[model samples]
Target chain A: MFSNRRSDDVAAPRAGRPRSETARRAILDAAADLALAETCVPTIDAVAARAGVSRTTIYKWWPSSAAVLAEALLDRFHESIEFDDALPVRQALTGQVDALVRLLRQTPAGALLRQLLAAAASDERVARALLAQWMDPRRESAAHHVARGVAQGDLRADVDVELVVDALFAPVYHRLVWGHAPLDADLATRVCDLVWPGIAATEP
Target chain B: MFSNRRSDDVAAPRAGRPRSETARRAILDAAADLALAETCVPTIDAVAARAGVSRTTIYKWWPSSAAVLAEALLDRFHESIEFDDALPVRQALTGQVDALVRLLRQTPAGALLRQLLAAAASDERVARALLAQWMDPRRESAAHHVARGVAQGDLRADVDVELVVDALFAPVYHRLVWGHAPLDADLATRVCDLVWPGIAATEP
Candidate 1:
């Protein structure tokens, strides 16, 4: 599930009427739309015009255009993938990885993510926004699930949770960025199967 | 070890004097220097000027500035890390990964690589150059090593060579680009240890 923490709420207290959920949704939607339609990150003015909100309104909510785009990306990811708690830890991990690989391969969000990553390399603001808005939240969710799996004896208690999370997910992004290999449908299953023996608890 | 295949040699046969090795080396060195010194990919003209070679000479040797930079990166990587054939498979892999982490963390090559990756995302030429000149060679080297391990009975014969290579190296690059965690001294050892159980041949 996505967090409800909006940048505007955390920036400073506002004396005006309660923040408009409608406006916030419109801004994010517009940002995502513009980012997908163009080769570059959408500008603040472009987003504001597309959303029919004043630039001041966008500025009030997000610190930068990259922040707005990051939120839009995070929103799309949340909509596309949901972790099923009822599944076994291994199955759940495989399913999550499979869904992510598919999202990156079969959607506009994939292109959007590539664009953000490219921009983040040069722009510190973009990098910070991506980390705070997108990568951190996703990593935290995975880490928590991994920790639970460890406690339940599905995974080894000695597992390094952060490294395990990286081992599970990093290859997907690596392929996505490097283009050295295919991000084929079975990649998730293959990756999980390869790392499973190292992370799984041994039978008594 | 780096391959000796030059892009110029593959493009077409040259009719004149043998290609100048001195010029080639100078061009690659200049390209690497400029890329590290600047935030953006240096232009062909800038590289030529820096190396004291004409634009035509650079063009004759490399199809694009990115190609030149890719070769430069490949050169630096070869200089920084060498795989010792005498070591056990696991130790060699661990050493290779650790050396790469150090190279990325402790050298200028790291910044140059980040710049190239950022540029590659937008420019098809850069992407192709990076894959052909840098990523493929690196992956090929790792693949050969893993295949050797399997042949030697040090690794599971059923292991996916490409995926195993990815597992060992991708996390380092992932952290490099994402900055989600530190590429510390022990990262390579930890990564190799985590994946070793899955990769190593089970004891009879």
Candidate 2:
């Protein structure tokens, strides 16, 4: 669903029939569903079969299965994460953590994330995409929100925003990859409580 | 090699011809070599073939390939990590970090770690083994050293041991998995400086 159907920077719109948005969505959905169901990654053939599209069509754009799945995951994240400034900084950070925990518990997206992490461990392209599109960008956005908290004197201005971001998010990643525990609301709350004081440190 | 090659438990009189320790060492060396190649994780079949051992010989003990590799990694570490109390706590912590960074830079060990991490992300068995054998053991060992420092008034009593361990370790891991940059002496010093103060914090 996230694969760009059309190329950017074209001189003008092509006269040919536009790509079918419905087909695109089906491909992504099928990829997500297949990822959750399978042991190893879902092959492009499996995705194409599930989506009722030719393998050629799937491969026409995405360079690899990881790329397709990465886009699908991004789509899921974009739909789920809503930035609301009205909530207090603490409230907002807490909510983001909760939301992230909840989303990770979803079998398909969680499995996909694990797959991408493994793929990224070895593949440079997947690594760059993950860092740029999902990991760092998300952290930067969270830091921006946390900066507002610092401005309001709700958090320590001296807090290393990047470190604070890592403190909050890296644990989730670490747990998901290593801890073998479900990232539930209780765990999220504990993390926030443990980290909030340090992150919100202020001059006496 | 650490696999059940005639239990050391049985009295020598009862045991049949003892397994050749040299052959065991050779098998481990070959496994590490193949893993460093990294096109695919070396399977028991491949390791056996490379080592000129029977498949039954490998499976007679290790339930999984990860088990074999895990033992090999541990064996490598055993040769390197000295478990004595001769070194001062602060010096030990610093030296241990340096040793770990150096170990991760090894061609075969590095590849094996990456493979194990990928395996850990997907397989619960691999994840548990890697944690028990490598990660948790080291952290626990490090925590004890840190506790001794606190007792001696060389570290902060309130410093969260787990947090300190994670902070000290995670950046090195992040570098290992993400960046190609060498973990230089300067970076090691910075890590010590950044972490030692917090751990050494007094009521100032």
Candidate 3:
């Protein structure tokens, strides 16, 4: 789960017994499962009931339901996204996009992302956690990969890496929130093909 | 406001004079204004008080605050977006993007959009109304314009009109919901430039 941001700093030899890794896993699993249900974002009490843990234990770790579900989503997303550098830059971009589309299609993780998006719209703490702990980490890594293309002269050295990253990722996020368009591997491929020539150094 | 969807079908020629357009406008304005305030979405009682209309009058029209806000947001959005076909394809796209960015930065309309996004995430009715009444019509128009470029051989005829439209619009929406990046003309121009060559039939 992604809520580990401050855990490293604060967790060094905590005053009490080390937090139960088993309890944490139970809480996360229950939270993830509950989020997929046809209901509003799962309540903390509901999560506790599902996990068979006290409300105190869940609250002790996560500040809110969005935080718990975000971490749960990251658990799945982390396993799915694997970078493949052997392919050409365009293919590499498309491959990464392929993995991302899968992560979003899951009922639980997808719903969690939507809930976090709404929460982030209004709540700064939720916003920072999602951006810093989840999106930015992946985005920064993607930027670095893009910078490799620029450095190798595969891309125009002047190509804005940040903008390219947005070009690659924003449509997925946009479709996730709006529900107006299809979110699929084919759409991702089209996005890559259209964007590739713009950034490529040589004439298409 | 937007809740007018089924009302026209249901609210058949109500007694006590016809529904007042003046009262409707006041209700919508008050609803939009209250949404911008740092408060919960305006309640029927609150809106009625703010608009100086009876709660019965509000119930006679809008189903919810989000409905009124959606209509108000559309009012400004419709006036603001004017496409100019005289310009070339790329320039025309940029022109439309410029107007959209302006409408979103306004206090009331911008906040209403954010609130509605949150509402849409949780409520299917709100999502359907937003897509049906607000976004789809505009998106369908934008796709038509992109199709023009393809038909005229200005852009590669193979380009996907829907994907191009998504490329043109999604970054702005991504910025709106996430608040992670700047949403401005400069960003819009950069998006157009990156996407143009890939879609364009001719060399830069």
Interface RMSD of each: 0.8, 4.1, 0.9
Pick the winner on lDDT between candidates 1 and 2.
1
Predict model 2's lDDT versus the native: 0.65
Candidate 3 on B1-204: residue-level lDDT in tens?
123342342245455434476677688778767766743467778888999999888776666666666665565456444465666777778777766776667555566677788889889878876776567766766776788788878888788787788888888877777777777657778888888888888754
Model 2 alpha-carbon miss at residue A8, Å: 8.4
Which rank order by TM-score, best down to worst? 1, 3, 2
* Model 1: residues with Cα > 4 Å off, grouped in runs: A5-19, A37-40, B1-19, B37-40
TM-score of chain A of 1: 0.90
DockQ of each: 0.79, 0.26, 0.73
TM-score-best of 2 and 3: 3
What proportion of the true contacts does each candidate reproduce?
A: 0.69, 0.20, 0.81
Off by over 4 Å in 3: A1-26, A37-40, A46-61, B1-30, B33-41, B45-62
Clashing pairs in 1: none
Candidate 2 lDDT by residue in tens digits, A1-204? 122422221123244325545556677788777776673457888889999988887776566677667666665576344567787887777777677787777655666677787888788877765664456545655787789888888887777666566556655666666663446556556566656655664567
Query: Residue by residue across A1-204, what tens digits does model 3's lDDT show?
Result: 223543452234355444566677788778777776643468899889999999888777777877777766665466444465565666667777766776777445666778787888788878876775567756765776688788777889899887888898888888888898878757677778878888889855
- Best prediction by DockQ: 1
Model 1 agreement with the true structure over A1-204: per-residue lDDT tens digits = 445554443455455335566788899999988887774579999999999999999887787888899888777667434576677778777887888898888877666777788888878888888898888877776777788899899999999999999999999999998888899999999999889898989997
Better of 1 and 3 by TM-score: 1
**C-alpha lDDT (0 to 100) for residue A185 of candidate 1:** 92
What level of docking quality does candidate 2 show?
acceptable
How many collisions between residues are there in candidate 3?
0
